[model samples]
Target: MMGRTVLVTGGSSGIGRAVAARFAADGADVVITGRRVDTVAPAAEALGVRGLACDATSPGQVAALAGELGGSLDVLVNAAGGLPAAPAAGTPPLEALAQEWLSSVSGNVLTAVLTTTAVRDRLAPGGAVISVGSIGAERRGGSYGAAKAALAAWNVSLAAALGPQDVTCNVISSGYVAGTGFFGDGMTEERHRALVEETLLKRPGTPDDIAQTILFLASPGARHITGQTIHVNGGAFTTR
Candidate 1:
């Protein structure tokens, strides 16, 4: 990623922050975006990168961000996604479930769609689009998993559209990445043990694990790789 300008959404924290740092360490001109202006600016400055305050779910904000960068983007990492704090409740029997599902869709799927659409035209030739996915989508869970499944499906079309431009699009389906907000408050000892037990490596993943994969996907080494979901789950699940 040397000399490349990479943009990581939701870079204020978690996997996004790690991705931004990895690219910056590789000498890329890194730019990170988050809804929190204060958090993003300081983190970017500390990491010797630029910061932009843009909500990935908002098309206008994403467009303005692209304009600020002079409309030339080399890499776009869609890492902004999570479940809502509380499910939306309603009078109808299934209204809460419906609202919760919508919230997940808005957060995980729509956010990536809006950001990708706004910058698709400005993406440089040979650009790469990497979205952070979750193993939750494959596990028994709620709307969050469903949304991630949608994201993976959407990336397929994106890859096809950008293939001719030499822009590869892919998703990294991560698993048990520790030190993230996926556990909400935090991971307890028992929960951590269970997660590790389920993995072949008998350990939890880290942000750097996903970051390294993103770096590979963005590099010339992975030029031929596109329209695929690469699992980074330590053999938690495998395809025949």
Candidate 2:
């Protein structure tokens, strides 16, 4: 990865932070972006990489980020998303449901769409575009799941279009990963145990687990693996 330029959105924490650190460890010129400057700046400094503040879901911000990059990128990791927030109190039931659904779609699907489109021309040939998906897309994923499923669907067409350019695109559907605030402050002990029990490994996944897969997809060995959603759920869900 040395001398290669890697861009990771939402790299201020969680899976994104891990991915950025992994690439930086391999000597890649890594640049991480988050919506907040204060958070992203510290994370970038800690990882010893450059940091940019950009709200990926916004076209204007994404365009600004692309402009900052000077139209050159070797790898793009779209890890800028998470579970949707709960509906606000005093909101009507129907409106609350709608808000939750829209939040999920915007955070998970729109973020990737806007960012990838903004940087499409900047993507170097033979580069990789890796998006973070979720196992929720498989079972009772609700709005978050639906959004992630859409992400995979979009990646297929994206792969087809970019394949001719020697670029690869794929999605990584992650399972119940630990070490991040993904579950926020609502993760109960029983729920945590249940999640771990569901996995064959009987343990929750770490950010490094997902980061390692992203690294492989970016490597030369994975050139032929495009337009696929690779599940890293420790046997919680299997694709036939």
Candidate 3:
């Protein structure tokens, strides 16, 4: 990864942060983006990478970020998404439900879509575009799961479009990962245990687990692999 330019969205913390750190350690010129300047700056400093505040879901922000890069990108990691926050105080139940669904789709799906579109032309040959997905896409995933499923679907077409350019596009469908604020205050002990038991490894995944996979997918060894969703869920959801 030495001399390569990498961009990771939603890299203020958690899986995104881990991925950025791994690339930076490999001597890549890495830049991380987040919605908040305070968080992004601190995380970038800690990882020895540059930080930019840009909302991936917004075309304006994404365009500005691309302008800032000003050159070809060797890698683009679309890690800028999560479970949607609760709807604000509302007068109607149906509207709140609709908002939740929309939030999920915009946050998870649109973020990847807009960001990738903004920088598609700037992706260098041999580049890799990796998006973070979720196991929820396979099972009883609600709105969030549905959005992740869309992400994987989008990746297939993207891979084909970029294939002729020697740019690989893929998704990393992550499982139950610990040490991240993904669950917020909603994760109960029982829920945590149940999720762990569901995995063949019988333990929650770490950020490094997903980070290491990103490293490989961006490497020369994975040059031939593209347009596939690699599950990193500890056998929680296996595919034929």
Where in model 1 is the C-alpha error above 4 Å?
A: 88-93
Preferred candidate (lDDT higher): 1 or 3: 3
Using all chains and alpha carbons, the TM-scores for the candidates as numbered come to: 0.94, 0.98, 0.98
- The whole-model lDDT of each prediction reads 0.88, 0.95, 0.95
Question: Model 3: runs farther than 4 Å from truth?
Answer: none
Clashing pairs for model 1 are: none
Evaluated against the true structure, the overall lDDT of model 3 is 0.95
After superposition of all CA atoms, the RMSD between model 1 and the true structure is 1.7
lDDT tens digits by residue: candidate 2, 54-124: 98878899988999987589999999999887887999999999999999999999999999998888899
lDDT of 1 by residue, 1-240 (tens): 568989899887889999999999999999899987989999899888999998877778878887887758899999998875565344575877777788889889998999888888888998999998888889874789888999999999999999988899999999889888767866789988988898899888999999999999999999899999999988887765
